[model samples]
Target chain A: MIDVQLIGLLNATLQAATLLFIAALGELITEKSGILNLGVEGMISVGAVSGFITAINTENLFLAVIVGVLSASAFSSIHAFVTVVLKQDQTVSGLILTILGLSLSSLIGKPYVGKKLEVKLESLIDIEEPLNIFQVLLNQNLIFYIAILLMIFTAYVLKKTMFGRRIEAIGEDLKSADSMGLKIAKTQFIATCVGGAFAGLSGVYLTLSYVPYWTDGMTSGRGWIALALVIFGGWKPYRTAFGALLFGFLEALGPRLQTYGFEMSPYIVKITPYIITILVLVFLTIIKNGNTGAPKNIGIPFFRENR
Target chain B: MNKFILSKKLYRNELATFYSFLIGFLIALAVGSLILFIQEKNPFDVFSLMLKLSIGSVNSLSNSLNKAIPLILAGLGISIINSVKLWNIGAEGQIFMGAIALNFVYINTSINNSQIYIFLLLVSGFLGGAFCILFPAVAKVLFGVNEIITTLLTNYIVFGLTIYLINGAWKDPASLNFPAAAYVSESVYLPTVIGKLSSGFLICILFTLIAYYIKDKSVFGYEMRIAGGSALTAIYAGINAKQKAFFAMLIGGGFAGLAGAIELLSQTHRVSTGISQGFGYTAIIVAAITGMRPVGIFLVGCLFGALTIGGSVIQTIGVSSYIAEIIQATTLFGALIAQFFFSYEILKKSEND
Candidate 1:
């Protein structure tokens, strides 16, 4: 019975960690390319709404997830355009996007409120075999496996590849990189868009695999946690996966503890992820002596010439 | 020839801002029209109806003015900090704490003594907001934690704390099952000064003047500009960056708190979660769009206030209130894009540069 309980708890933890992992990966890429995309929450909401609505209408989980990713990326592109191309304050632009996304999603998703759907993924290789921990962990919807693989791929690309070097060079010092024949604008723009695409995909994964249903503000605060995970991971893909897992464990443990007859205010338990973020941020602060190895040009707008 | 070059540059920059604003307006109109179009209604008719409802009558005009009151104050707070390059995202939280503090005074003590109570309430709100900066201020000053993170994090903490209190200790008993505090007495209410216009409008104007005075004429203001424009230069000139950031955030928090107080006492007449209503967040955009200048903040605030109030008027035509939000978002996007022109010239090709 104890072993069974442990398995259930670990499964819940892995399930809960998927959204944050996807989002943190997205943010990690953007930050690596020297931009702070604060619109993750907004993009998540947009994806949730889009994914939920598409899935409900067609009753096709695959199509719904695709729609979710596209919608979130499209929404995030607007953020990229405003902050990157237009040279606005990324923080303010992001806050506005959050409000816009939340309000817009709520208004549009009103029709589909309370409607539920069970996601039926296309059959895969026999993965859900009973009692094997590896199979149990890997038996999640295809997106969960994809998320882990993407993290590994991202780690390899960022650490080993030449493209990764250029991205790092640009983020470290755009002026120096420009002098070295790097296309600063094009590189940053692509990084931001790709980051946005992954962010949207995270939201799609949330709606399709984890929640498997539609609701307004469904992925509440998960985006913020994902953002914190990027910081906790110190901007490395592998470390970010670890941070996501920790967050997922905390979130899953909260409800499970209640289920096991532990008495605690759900509100207090809900604050666990935020409290952990604070602690991790403090730890990272100590590690960096306050600098935290931030991208040199990370929130600063780059102008081609001196005006 | 040099003068001509400068003039050309200025025109290009101005034109960018103008185009951004124009595009924002077009987007707003398109969104409004899209909503109507989707509803199978005539877009033109719905828009006209919105105009008629928002400013078409004295009642609606009063409503718009009331809405403008808190926005103008919050906009000023946003404007000041942006000038110093400090990201004070804690405004909403500051405002919430301010409202909570003001209510404590208004409810616990009898304001029936004199008109001084109003002044006291205003001061308390300002102080309350300033107080909310305690933890984050310490974090930034001592540890160099990005004020952005601390300030934003505090907002959720304060919001959660407020909800916890309201649901537990502060729940009104005389009322029905709703979670609310007691309605404040009339003596504490801000009096109406004009034909249905409350004194909140006058407070907004007065605060605007004070902010303008401090920003443009004060010696302290000059130091703040120096610090914001060039931290290295300011440090060389003997200005402490930590102290400057602290002072800017303190004032910013206070002004936002004052907005919360005004919102509570003058408009809502009770404390609730809806009091902030993105006003603190949107105020940042208002400040940015106006280039962080006091006069510009006032104008921008009025424009947005008109848009918000006008949006409600058009709601009778089955248009969602989110149309206002779309307008706000697009306008902010436009303004930020416009700001890029001030720093860089957009050439037809990279080779031109």
Candidate 2:
């Protein structure tokens, strides 16, 4: 019984972590390209709504996911134009993007409230009885496997590719990068769009596989948590993936513990993830002496002539 | 052939912000109208009705003012912190903490004098807000942790605590099935200046005046400006940048808390999760569009409050109130674009060069 319960908890933790990891990976890319997009929450909401609507009308989960990703990417282009092209404050612009995305989602999503997705994203392998923990872990939806593969691919691209190096160079020192003839604006715009796409994927995963339903404001505070995860992981793909799992464990532990008849306020359990994030942030900042490998010019906008 | 060059303006344009707001307001109106048109409603009719319902009558105007009370106070708080180049994104959480603190004091004490009780609750609310932000401020100052993330994370934690209290310890026995604390005694209620308008409106004005004075005419304000402008310069000028940032954060938190306390004592009279309707978040926009000026905060707060009031009123006509948020966001974007132009003028490059 104990072993079975532990396996169940681990499975739940991985599932929860998949959502956070996907979103944070997108944010990691955006931040790595010298743009701070606080519109992740907004993007996720838009993606979820659009994806749900598509799924309801067409009953095609694959097409729904594509539409979700495309719409969110389009939405993020506004932030890209306002912040990157216009050279505005990233923080404020991102916040506005969030507000706009949220409101826009609600306005369009009004008709689809309380509607459920007809088809669900299914797992890759279906075994009636799992022989071990590995099987149990592998018995997740397609998005879960995609999340892992994406993490590995991202780690490889960021560490090995010239494109990744150019992104880092721009983020670290935009003036130097521009002097080196790097297309700062184009690279940052692409990076921001990529981030939006990942955020959309996370949203699609939530609606199609995780909850398999439609609800307003269902993304909740996960986007913000993903933002924190980027910092917590020091903007590294592997480290961020690990941090996502840690947060996922905390999120899953709350309900699992209650099911096991533990005596604690559910609300207190819910708050543990946030409290732990703060503690981890403080610990990391102290050990790193304020240099947590963040891109030096992460939030600053670049203008060629100004440089 | 000539290329456009962005040249920095030599003189500060004070009227630039005014013009920017006008442009932003018009942009927001256009967006709102477009959205309404898509919904098969007449944009002009909805807008005119919104204006009429929000400010046409004395009672409607009073309701708008009442709504503006919390917005002004919270906007003042945000402006204070923002002036110091710090982001106090936890204002929403701080507001809840203030309400919790006020309720704690009200429920525990047996103070008979209404004046004393109200004063004590107000102070407690301020302290509560300050206390909530203290951790994040200290973390930012001492450990060099990013306050933005820390402050935002605390919001979730505080919200959880509020839910815990209301559902468990503070749950009122008389109000069956409702997740809220019992109402306070009538003696502790804030006095009304007019129809449905609490004395909180006066408090907002008083706080705004004090903030304006501090920001425009005080030594601390000057030092704060220097510190926010450049920490290295501030150090050279014998100003403790860290200390200033800490105090500014606390003050910002206090403003949010006071808004909460006033909101509780004057409006709700009870503690519930629905006490704050994102006033803290909306106040950020209020501060942003106003350039963090105390006077601008007041004016923008009133405008947004009116928009919110009118937006809700139009819900009767099958229009979603989310239109208000959509408008507020577009206005911020428009103002941002306008600010870009105000600071940098486009110039034609000479062919000779």
Candidate 3:
């Protein structure tokens, strides 16, 4: 018989994994369109701050999330303009964006510190008493379901669509894609914007559900982990979600282990996710020659130069 | 009617750069004003206050320079690695490791000579910073891993380990509640040169000068330029791209480590998690604004240093330092756009073959 603590651990895993999975999937789409966005962290920061402000002022969860996506995408558009149109270095722009985002959010969250939510995000599914496996799986915050739905939708869109093929072509060989009449610039811009939207939603989840309070720098490297998950997932949505779940499980280990009488140091437990990420990347590199599955022109900005 | 058409410039004159920075600063000011307006604060008042706070007196000026010590050092590292087109995003973690290294040396080794002990601590800082990036740098060189992800992930590990040390192993008993390591022996503290600025600021300048020489006046620097421009060109030119990559990361990481050591030895005098204060991130922006020019980094590092203090100035009136961040980011974007214009001019449309 499965223990209640095990079920509780699994539940915590779903909540933790949901936000990360959403962010990774968004990044996967952005990368698929041939741009390696290093600014997801920044976008999330902007989203979280804006989302928190929106939540507090309007007391509308959905509007708050919408604002979150919009603010995040607004910041990302600047990156797109710089890297895409200006052909500036993507990695540098991404770093600056993170600094800007974190700083901006810190400023925004300063006033809202220790502020509690006036309204809680209501769950989409309501079930009480005698919870079976189905009930257990179904009973979660609304954002959790949205994340699972998004994962499936993204995986479907990536695998079985003409748009997907266009992105794949652009990522692999932008010159060839341009020759074949693909809208490289437009597609990349839109993809990055869409990615930014989901990144915003990820931040919204953090403020509304995960941590559920306004705190400065609360995203706290979750954005970076999401970026790593994109790599470990090989830029595939379902795999990215799987990576998120595993990371979440590791994250939930502190509480779960405590229940099992392990009593590990929380700080040490906090680092397990990053340590695993580094080990996995190293191992993947050392294994040698099975296809890293990275987009070919991901970091190289596309320019309309007739060479 | 005239239409913009980009034309490549044969040689970039100094006028273009001057114009670009002027325009960049203007744009940043404009963006900052917008943010201030949203916050219901007077933009002019806050900006002027920030300026006053940064350089209103000798003590404050020295304070700004002291804070810029880490950024200048870290900026040099960013500029070096950037020459080889490598992203040095792990400077924050490297900075933390540098502090850890200095504390490790101070706690474990008993060196009485202040000069010699400080020198050794500096080396340890460099090693710690370099050590943090070595594994990832090797991975990037050998396995084709993206340095951005690898470097970034290492920051978390470094942070966790640092917190673990300060809270668990190296926790000071006397400091009742604060999670800081045992203070470095007072003999190890460097003498302050300016009002509050330590000799570390001078060390940062010296390192920047050394970096400038390596970047502008060395064969290895030339090789790094070639590799950054085109890997194929570098390989064909027999530049040994792998070695350049490794050297770039090591040198860059070392500079950041030195910054960490500077902090520990200069002011903080103790290893703590707040040592970096995002200097690693800010230095990347500084490097980008100057387009990795060694000289430009020095000037911009000072400007950013002022802004770093400016970030706190507004906090007195219940304003967030985010304005500083916003202004810095906007200025970087503006400068980048100007750089783009410098390289490719938008000429009036004309029929040409």
Candidate 4:
């Protein structure tokens, strides 16, 4: 019975982890191309609204995911243009994009406030009768399986592909990459847009697959937590997945604690992810490992012609 | 020659500000109109009402001034940090923490003398703001953590910690359910210099002058500028980069703290969660709009403050006061977009090309 419960817990963990995994993967691609995306929350919010509205209209869940991803990618392009091309302060630009996106989403999503939708996709797939591992992991939504496949694919691309080499080079030294005839701006832009798509995809999971309701500021701070998960994972694809799972566990921990009759402040539970992030940061600092690598020029606004 | 005179350098600069302001206002109006339309309301009436309420009379003007004072102070706080190439996103947190610190001091101790009261208030405020900065500064130096994330995260921590305190430890004995601190003693309240206008507004002007003087004349300011301009060059010039950064953050935090203190003593007259109401965050827009100039911050802050006050009074015309948030956001959008002109040029492609 305890073992079955543990499997159930793990299954629950995967559900929560899927959204964050998508977001972190998206952020990783952006950061790998040397642009730190702080507009994850905004992108997610836009995604949530876009996904919810589109799903309600079309009644096609997959189409909603596509719309959500595309919108998020479009939203993230603004960050790319300002930071990569315009060479503005990345942090300020990202912060402004966040505020703008938040307000813009609220304004645009005003009509659908308080309305809820019953999604049909939740029962569309049930793989639990198949192979045990697949049943345990892939038995959830199609998006959950897609998210895992994306992680594997991303890890493969980052490690084995020539495109990844160029991205790595750009992140390591833009000047050197430029000298070597790489298209710096183009690479960063594409990566950023793709990253944004993942963030949006995460939003689709929330709207179409998870709650299937429209609420103002529904994405909440999941985007920021996703960003932190990228750091907690020490900037590796596999570790990033694990970190997302850990965060999911913490997120689910709130409800579990309540269920287990251990009454705790919801605020304290709400703060657990942040507290864990700080703890992870402190632990990372103390270990002082030389192996974990962040992109050298991650937040630096690249000005090609200025040099 | 006529064209040259029309495009004269001084006129060109004035034209820039004029165009920017016009564009910002129009954009805000368009957005506000769109929102009103969605809600099935008339936009023109709402805007007209907004204008009337904001600038209609002396009372509204005073109300706007009252709003502008704290915004001006917050803007100054933002400008100081930005001038040194630091993004102090913790101002909201700093303001709240500062208020909490001041209130803690206020409720516990009774100071009869006015001088001691002012002294303790300023000290607590400065100390509170400074304490908030310590985390980011330490994170920057020790952990290689960017101050941006640390500062931003500190905001939630401060808010959470403060709320925890008010609920658990500092809940007023007499209040029914609302979590509120004790009423501050009258001696601790800031003196009102103008009729109905609190002395806090005066402090904003004083700080602006102080900021200008320090930025222009002081060696410390020069070091900060050098540090901001180039970290390598500052180090090459025998300036202690670490010390300068630490000092700049401290001053930035202290000024923000002082704003919180003044706000509590003058306006709210007590510490509460909504004391700052995102002033610290909005100040970023003020600072950026001003291009990190004290004069610019003062003007922009006043503009926002007036808009905020005007937003409320305009509700009689059926528009929500929250429209100010949209307008402020639009101004920031305009200001950031305007900065693009400074950085890049847009030109028509030639037919041959």
Best by TM-score: 2
Can you tell me which runs of candidate 4 are displaced by over 4 Å? Answer: A3-12, A56-60, A111-113, A120-139, A208-218, A254-265, A289-292, B1-42, B173-178, B185-187, B191-196, B312-322, B346-353
**TM-score: the better of candidates 2 and 4:** 2
lDDT of 2 by residue, B25-62 (tens): 89889989998998899999999999999999888988
The deviation in Å at residue A30 for candidate 4 is 1.6
Which of the numbered candidates is closest to the native, going by highest lDDT? 2
**B1-353, model 4: which lDDT tens digit per residue?**
11111111222354454455557667777877887887788888777776677667766666677777767776777667766788887888888778888887876787778878877987798789888888787766565665776677777777777777667677777655877666677777778665556777777888998887766678988988898889899989998777777777877887788878887887777777767877887787677666677877787888888888777776676666657777787765665566556446544444543
lDDT of 2 by residue, A38-116 (tens): 9998998888889988998999989999999899989998889888878888998887787788888988999888877
Clashes of each: 0, 0, 0, 0
Rate residue B337 of model 2 by lDDT. 83
Residue B305 lDDT, candidate 3, scale 0-100: 89
Question: Which numbered prediction scores highest in DockQ against the true structure?
Answer: 2
Record all residue pairs in model 3 with backbone atoms less than 3 Å apart, i.e. clashing: none
Order the candidate numbers by lDDT, best to worst: 2, 3, 1, 4
DockQ of 1: 0.44
| Interface DockQ of each model | 0.44, 0.73, 0.64, 0.28
**Which tens-of-lDDT digit does each residue in B119-229 have in candidate 1?**
898888998888887667767777766666667666776777667656666777775566666777777888887656788788888889988977788877777888888
lDDT of 3 by residue, B202-224 (tens): 88888888999999999889888
TM-score versus the correct structure, for each prediction: 0.90, 0.97, 0.95, 0.86
